[model samples]
Target: MNLRQLEILAAVVRTHSTIAAAQDLGMSQPAVSNSIKSAEASLGFLLFERVNNRLIPTPEAQVLLADAEHLFLMRDAVMQTASYLKAGRKGSIRVAATAELSESLMPQLISRFLQNHLGVDVSLETHRLDTVLNYVETGVSDIGFAMEPYPRPTLDQTPLATLDMVCAFSAKSELGRLQFVTPVDIDQMPMLKAGSGSRINKLIEEAFQKSRVAFNPSVDVRFMNVASYCVEQGVGVAIIDELTASCRPHTAMRTLPFRPRVQITLAAVSSNSRPQQRLVKSLVKYAREEISQRLRQVSKERSLKGT
Candidate 1:
């Protein structure tokens, strides 16, 4: 029988009279009686016996009532889950991010999100910027974090933060005394470079060109973390995004703002074909706040240090 019929059956069985059942269910007595008759017809059996102006449930009615109760419980659970999903408190969110962000930012963001949303499941994938965009474009990831100039025309991209590029150097180096590093300061010094064809490398080259200096590198690396590590080891000074350079407590590596302030724009990328999931949008908002707060904190600390 249908859920409404089963509900009427349950009400009648509980109240022991159609008149009482009708009052409990906000229906007329005849309406309750008709619903019981319909249920019984659908079940091909009598559900109740009328005697002494009272209703007594039959064996068949008891069995059906048990099943109906369980069905109602399951329906309640489904509704609760739907409410949770709608509120962005439950569901799975798949994210793909560039190596720099995945290592430096995603861990804290994902952890805080999980703490706030206990029922949500998060899957994180780390790759290069190109792969992160590909994952979002192909529907393999619900959201992606990568640096701009985002080349993917198939995905919607929102700029999240623009982090300045910083010159990273060993704490013991002579350049560490400077509050900022100008393109002229590092012109003659050996430098570690980002990948030759990377957007960051092009930006670095343009910065040097604007200063009327030649761009040169002692070592070439594909990742910002690698460049930072090389700077820490006194291999050479490198310009890398502030987020990647300042994420950890580094005693050996110190970062200074680069003069003329080369910047890397971080963006949230999502597929055009799929609607943005509630949890994914929540994550994007969380990430933006987290990064902004972090940058402000860093700026405050540097000001206090008189650097």
Candidate 2:
């Protein structure tokens, strides 16, 4: 029988009379009686019996009523779950990020997201830049954060932030005294470089070449954090993303704006094969807002410092 018929039956069982059930359900007595009769006819069983001018529930009626109550509960739960999903308040967000964003930004971003959406669960995976793109393309992750150029043809890209590259040097070094470091300033110095063929390394080399200076590195490393550590220990000056260079607290190193303004664009990648879910879209929006606020604050600080 239909939900309306089941509801009328339940109402009659609860109120013990067709007139009372109709009143409780805001329907006419004949309508309620007709619905109950229709339900009983569909099941080919008598749901109630008349004894001493009063209606008494049959054994079948009790069983059907119990099952009807369970159905109502299940319907309510389904509606609530749908509401949560529509509002982006409950779901799991799987994210993959490159080393730079994963180490420096994702932790804080995810923490803030968890705080705001307490019903949502987040899974964060860290990988190299290329692997992060793979995760997004293969649907292993819902979203990905990485540096450009975004090479995955199967993924849609959204630019998040563009960060200027900065040179990090030991606080005690003479070069640290300069407000900004020119490519020529570090030409002959022992340099700690990013891995060969990396995007950042190519940018650094290109900047030096544009200034008519030779590019040489005393040591080569696979990650920016390692290069930053080398700079902190006075191994040599290293040019790295602003996020990685700024992660250290009360550091023994100083960061100077590198000229002539090498920059990298950070972007969010999602699969093009499927429509984005509400939760994934909300996460990407929030991440973009946070990154924009951070970049604005950095710009303000730089403007004040005349750097």
Candidate 3:
């Protein structure tokens, strides 16, 4: 019914515990409970189900929580609009990114953008690919940086860069002697799986599935960084993203192209409904230019090596 109650409900959903939400809100547990109770009474339904003191938000609560988030963001937008009016060029751009972008590109792009647009504030939030897309869809972020193929009906996507996943090995490994890793070699070697859940692995899975060859994900890791670490420890070789392989902290490792398959893409997206803001436009332009240059440089290196 009120902003305070809506905020408390949203917090409870986010933290999944009343105690945690209370701590986060810097309020007493009793006060937080009272706010939720008041809100539920006003709505005439139970918003959350309690199981062992943990607040499991109901499906209806999920809708309300989403609405609450939108309302909160709308409030900020109003204030930002006022600031923009007063200062002419003062505002902020917020971006949500998945691993491919957050790994390094977003930070590098931000650094470059700030040099030219010093008056604009910038912030970034990293999340799963789906989560980042939703942030853009909801206008929670001015832009979303993610690895595609993403399922987005209401957003406009622009290709920022294309990424390739290649076999990486210690220089001492036999595979390191080969110019490229062939499909038959992958079948024999203990192929380091990037886990079935990774954004980049979706394409890899599709390719392997079509060929009727199993990926053989031995260790199911939750993070790409962990997979890289495992590869460094000689646990297994990794078919990691080009950006990941290029920046990986391993002097002894060499990345070779996967012979017949393996590729991913990085894309920048923004909601189609929201008209472009100056900061968002500037960021997209900067990212496109920088990423294109990097891609061209890599292509040239590959061409030279072909000779």
lDDT of each: 0.84, 0.81, 0.76
- Candidate 3, residue 190: Cα displacement in angstroms equals 3.7
Q: What is the TM-score of each candidate against the true structure?
A: 0.69, 0.68, 0.78
The candidate with the higher lDDT, 2 or 3, is 2
**Best model per TM-score:** 3
Once fitted onto the true fold, the runs of candidate 1 whose alpha carbons sit more than 4 angstroms away are 1-90
Q: Can you write out model 2's per-residue Cα lDDT over 176-197, one digit (the tens) per residue?
A: 6688999888878888887668
Candidate 1 has a TM-score of: 0.69
lDDT for model 2 comes to 0.81
Model 1, 1-307: lDDT tens per residue? 7888888998999999999999999999999999988877877889999889889999989988876655665465466556658887647777898778887899989987887888787878888887777667766678999876457668888899998998988888888778899889988788898766888788888999998988888798878888887887889899899888878887898888998778888889998888998888889999998899889988998898788
Best by lDDT: 1
* Model 3: residues with Cα > 4 Å off, grouped in runs: 10-34, 46-89, 195-199, 209-212, 222-226, 303-307
Residue 12 lDDT in model 1? 91
